[model samples]
Target: MILLIDSGNSRLKVGWLTATEDAATQTTANGQTAGPLMRREPAAVAFDNLNPHALGDWLGTLPQTPRLALGVNVAGPERAQGIHDALARHGCPVRWITSREQLLYLKNRYTEPTQLGADRLVALLGVRSRLPSAHPPYVLASFGTATTIDTVGPDDSFIGGLILPGPVLMRSSLARGTAHLPLANGQVTEFPTDTHQAIASGIAAAQAGAVLRQWLAACRYYGQAATLFVAGGSWPEVEQEMQRLLKQTGGSPNTHPTAYYLDRPVLDGLALIAAQPDPLSF
Candidate 1:
């Protein structure tokens, strides 16, 4: 078993993959098809925080110690060190996954590929590897400590992407940076009459708008059916808003992006990478 961890800015997603010699015959639980090396990922994964105990407890509960623990961290070096020590205590060797210039037949187009976040690259890999050939290009929006909207080509190219403050950050910033915005707790209504609803609706609109704009850009870039994939903690906050926003512009079935929710995509990506031969560097 290979343990996969997606270490975010303030949270961690954990999963386990049981790989066999006959990887060629396995398919992911999502039913998304991939190459012969592709295999099934854990049906459920543990979502935790930066606390050492949660991680230690989860490790203790594992049926067996993992031979290797692979992770991608956007939480900086200090936390990485802490995580390293925590896992080291459990006898699991740790390997960190970083962005490489090239991997899995996909070309990274960042001005410097190494600067790209490993979580983003890996999530894209998860989506790309399993995406059916029948679907067109797609946009992946990861909502976490920071939200990232990435556009990928049908030909396996990492075109480009944008980043913004995540939903919770948006509300928290308002409370911290402003005098009267009290960490809003409200719903996303079309016309928010109160401050609470206004703040809530505004955040949702910003997130959904950015996602839709990127989805539209992908459509323009590829001139084909483009799907919208929303992943991460804050996705539920804006999922409905995004659907409603899409309805306003998507007059026909083919005119707008069809949305799909991905569960712990970074872990899925790690599962795929775990099965494939190690790249020269990661």
Candidate 2:
């Protein structure tokens, strides 16, 4: 068993991968079984509040102790230390993943590639690994504490992206920065009459606008439609608005870029990286 962790800004996601042999891939010449065979397992996952105590307890609940642990941390070095210590207690040290100039066919186009977040890089790799046959122009939107909308170009390169305040932050900042807004808890309506609805509607619009702009820009740059993958906590609040926006927008030569919501893509990506025989090689 292998353990994979993604320590994000707000939470920590853990996945347990139990590798098994594939019956189809195990056969060799002369109807003899191969020396070794392994197939990918659908990982079982769990989460914690990013606290050392909570995370440690969760690790203790795993079905069996993992032999190796691999993870990516963007929650700061302190949290990284906590994760390291917890895994170390279980006798399975973690190998932290970082950004790279390149990873096999995927190239980092960031001016300073190392500055890119490991979560984003790993998430992109996860998407690419899932869509092995598809080529170019993919948009990934993560709406957590902060919203990140990134694009993968035709050449399989990270073409940079936009980072903006998430819906929660936008509303909280409004309430925090000013005195009048009472931390809007209103639902989004077509025409908001009250302040609460107005704040909620505006925040929804902002998130949708950011996602749409990036998706459309990628479409125009690549001269084709781009598939959009959205993940994170605030997705439920923004999905409807984005779907409305896409309907209002034209597709023309290409069909509408399908928007699919993914749960914990960062974890998915990390699991894929950890499964690699030489993950650090990338």
Candidate 3:
């Protein structure tokens, strides 16, 4: 089994897959069959108060020992070391993934390719692997601790994108930065009357607006409607608002773009990367 880990700022997501199954074909939403195949459900653990011994004990309960372990860590070196130690205690050495100028058919367009986050790069690869060869340019909006909207061209190039504070972070920032912001805690509304609802509404609008802006930009750049793939932990909180915004800004009557909620896209990408002949070499 090949173990794939996506260690993000807030949590760690892990999945196990057979090397052979990773190469097997399976149809995706775009009707392609080249995406990564998971042999088991992925598991997540929050970073707060994380206990490596508890994590190791849980790893020990898996059905079988993974022969190879691959990871993309955006949780800093100390947390990465903690993950390595946990996996090592269970007899699996980790080969953490890093950003590269190029990998497989995907080309990095960042001025400093290595400075790009590995999780973002891997998510793009995951989208590419699942999409048909003729798929249009696409945007990936990840709503985690920090929200990121990355663009991928039709030819599989990682174009530059945008980043902003996620909903919770936005609320926290407002509460801390200002004297009387009370940390918003109510459902979003079209026109909020109360301070809490107003804050909630504004946060959702900001996130939705960013996605719509990127979606429109990708469409303009590609000269066609582009797909928007949404992922990350906070997606559930903002999905409805994002969908509403997508409909509102779709422009032409006949040119509404497609949007999909791809669960654990980073992990999906890591699994595909792990299947490569020498994934660590990149």
Candidate 4:
């Protein structure tokens, strides 16, 4: 098994890709579209209080020890070290992916190219690999703790990106910042029937509006249509709202005919990168 991990701001996403017949199907089931869909699901996943021992113990129970472990972590090296130590306990070698100058198509534009978060790098890598069109740019929107909007030009250049608070953050911030808006818990109800719905609507609009604006701007500046892929914890919950926002904002011409959400896109993207035959060896 090849282990893939994504350590985001609030949660640790662990995935394993086993060498088995069911791998493809399982990948599809994990909110991933296998084959041409450009993503996959981790064999298994867990979320904890970010405890290394708990994570390690969980991985230890898997059917087999992973031979290669690849992941992108936002928690920085200290937390990554803990994971490395734990994986070592199970005899699984770990390799934290790096953004070298020429490893992949992403030409980093960050002030410190290497300083970019692994999750963003992996997501960009996957986007470039899957959509290599020379005319239309690719826009990647990650809607997790904070919604991030990054773009890769038609020439496969990694320009910078924009970031804003995510849905949860938007709701929580509204509740905290305003007196009338109560804390919006995680419950889905029909649109604004009262103050709560109005609050939810406002929060949802803020979150979705950011995506729509960025997506449309990319389309306009790039001079070609763009593919918009949305993935994050809140995406499933607010997909329809996002779709409605997209339609209302009139950015579909720039947005892809279909938007996709992959089960473990960052992990799957890393796996795809790892699968490439080492050019150095060849």
TM-score of 3: 0.87
Full-model lDDT, candidate 3? 0.77
Model 2 misplacement above 4 A: 20-41, 48-50, 251-255, 280-282
Off by over 4 Å in 1: 20-44, 133-135, 253-256, 279-281
At residue 161, what lDDT does model 4 achieve? 84
Which candidate number maximizes lDDT?
Answer: 1
lDDT of 4 by residue, 178-280 (tens): 8787886543444667776776776676766777777777778887666777777777656766766665555456533445554556765666665666512
Candidate 3 residue-wise lDDT at 205: 90
Task: Give the per-residue Cα lDDT of candidate 2 at 6.
Answer: 80
In candidate 2 the C-alpha lDDT for residue 169 amounts to 90
Error of 2 at 250 (Å): 2.7
- List lDDT for all candidates, in order: 0.77, 0.76, 0.77, 0.68
- Give me the displacement of residue 62 in model 2, in angstroms: 3.6
- Give one clash count per candidate, in the order shown: 0, 0, 0, 1
Candidate 1 lDDT over residue span 173-209, tens digit each: 9999998788998989999999999999999999999
- Could you tell me the lDDT of residue 72 within candidate 4? 73
RMSD of each: 4.2, 7.9, 4.4, 4.4
Window of ten residues with lowest summed lDDT in model 1: 21-30
